[model samples]
Target: MVQINFAQKQVNAKIVYYGPGMSGKTTNLEVIHQRAPEPNRGDLTSISTDGDRTLFFDFMPLDLGTVAGMRTCFQVYTVPGQVYYNSTRKLVLQGVDGVIFVADSSPDMMEENLESLRNLQENLSEYGRSSEEIPLVIQYNKRDIPGALPIEVLEEKLNQRGAPAFEAIANTGQGVFPTLKALAAAVLDSLHKSSGSSVPASAPAAQPVAAPQAATAQPSAPAPAAAPAPQRQTISMSQTGFHKAPSLPLQGAAAPSEAQAPDKGARPPQNAATTPGPQALGGLQLKGGSEGDGGGLRMAQPATPPAPEQPPTQPSLSMAVPPQPPAAAPAPTQAPPATATATAKPQTPPANRPATPGSMMRPDGGSPPPRRAPASKSFPSKVQEAHATPKGGKPKSAALTVLIVVASIGLGAALGSFVLQIL
Candidate 1:
């Protein structure tokens, strides 16, 4: 529901650090805040009640450079890590641009990590957000600890399809920036592909104060007539495994402007004032469906099943950016035989050779003699040949061949004698 203004050349993206209590979600945020350059970061804020530990959330905005021409900003938050804050956790997930499921690498915390993952899926569904389509990155936090599980096992149990996963020692800042970089990149890339933007979308600059109703509306302006609507269309859900969720009506663009402003030291309001409104047509009301549903502000009607057999096609989340294959080594060539002989046969020609006008030549550039008809003499008749056998019953042995040889010898001798006489 967060709207980023393309005209202002700024994009605002939401990234949540979600995991079980003590999984280092908050610690990851803190480390990022500490390590991030001052110009790109903001003050870290936490809200707690009854000494139950940090309950609500913490947020810090980071300004990543222009994608295309838009100024990109990442708004990062951590959800309440405790079990009692289930409602609060679900509430925070609304309008998430991307997710970083920070799992505890501790062997003992495996179950809790899994529970948190399951809860994330459930919350996403309840809020009508597709868990698969949201730009998601996995972080195995606390990887510096001894006796941690191998990253492979964690991937198998958590990331079945091999989403971008990272190993992080959030306390020491290892793998944290990579994690942020990947998610932010994915979010902007996805938005650009969807919007047909040449540049990745960026967060809009902070806007001046406006009325609440006007606050939610997109700034009114006609798009440049020269830029055509994108010709390339994304795949429809009918052709993909993704399931589409009903689009949530627009809320204010970005987190309320209070979260981003000139006053860096300003504190968050005691509570964000939320007013309930009537449900839009065709949109179902499931758990976590409304902003007010988290705090029992009001109960809406139960959801009706979407139209039969015509399931809403979900938008694709696994970006199909052209994949880069691993580099290949050059193929080794086999050297030709050192010498050639009659039996050292020529290789079979390639299957695709076209018939040439003349017979192929030998390697030495000589045209082999035109092949003659095989010199086979045919007998006049089978019976006649039988009668021609000699008195000893042995057939005449190659008479024609003997005659030919004798003639060749006599001709050679005659030519030699003539040449000697002339000399």
Candidate 2:
């Protein structure tokens, strides 16, 4: 996958170097790490076993300068090449954007090269990818070795799709950069071609050209020349499915000049009425005049209704009446003088007042009621109390003595019976 980072303004891609074991895959990465410019490369990391065989992979990040305003970064990896390490090799192929097959060109390693290429195709198939779709380059490595096979034989066996090929002695850094550069360029070009297809078909392709023109025209101020520039620019952007830029104020001013040639004052009212467009500049209102009214321009003001009139009333001599002290309320009819009739004698206690123990009245006319006893314990609590024994009491020696006597009597009766049977 090729990843585009809009926030960081960067484009990232993955490229893996794959081939048979000891085919100079690791060597190619080491040469690149050592020779690439300090600023353009990152740390070279390798995971390998004691024999220096790449156990997993080697990683090196290469930064190529900006392309179409985005920084380009290619993360390069070299997968372990041993047959038993196919699992790690498959994992390293994940999300690969490009491939560089480092074929060992010595005559002895031809079979290994073919096996590795077939393995590459199988691993890519698992990811629903095909080697034909991804950008690929081949490096015929170990070419400087004696008895190395000819380049034609290597290509026939490996470069079946006519991918770019380089004869490389990776140990001495020969052809390393050319191989890398070819793959990187292919990856970027593929990304560019792919990005083009994502654009909407309805979009106008020429809009980008107008953007540069607008940016260049920013310093000019002549109304006539500046007027058409923005109009053309807006139309181009609008056609391209881009948000239309705001119409320049100068463009509006140009309209008035063009309209001035045709009886400027009379034209405004006619245009205002007939067009029914937006209001005039500077908040001015244009209203058509009626026939009887002299057709002259007038400053308009809001209309207000006239207030109503009221009839006057005659002045009265007592309009201001003097406040009179509230009339004193009639004396509350002396409450009819409370009567002195004698009160009835106090009633005597009832003759049949019950004589209950606590109900007896004292001579002083009041007695306190007797307190009741507390309620008994619950059933469960009484059972628990009955089973509880005194903690300090001695163990039951009498029960142990009775058990011993019963056992001795049973044993003696058994012995006497056995003796009678023997006699």
In model 2, pairs of residues that clash are none
lDDT of all predictions: 0.47, 0.51
Model 2 poorest ten-residue lDDT run: 370-379
- Going through the candidates in the order shown, the clash numbers are 8, 0
Q: Write the per-residue lDDT of candidate 1 for residues 1-423, one digit (tens) a residue.
A: 334897888888888989888676765675565446556665444433322134677666778677568887888888987888899899889889888888887788788888998999899999887777776767776654556787766766876534556665443334455566556655655565444346523432111111122211121111222111111111111111111111111122122211112111011111111211111111112111111112110111212332212212211111222334434312111112221111111111122222212212211122111111001111111222323434433434567668889999999999999999999
- Where is model 1 poorest over a 10-residue stretch in terms of lDDT? 368-377
For residues 1-423, could you state the per-residue lDDT of candidate 2 as single tens digits?
999999999999999999998887876775565456667777555555423456678787888778669998999999989899999999999999989988887788899999999999999999999987887777777654556788767766776666666665454344566567656656765665554675444322221112223211121111221212211111111221112212211122222112212111111121221221111111111111111221211111112111111111111111222454445323222122222111111111111222222112211122211110011111111222323443323356666777888889999999999999999
lDDT of 1 at 370: 12
Predicted structure 2, TM vs. truth: 0.46
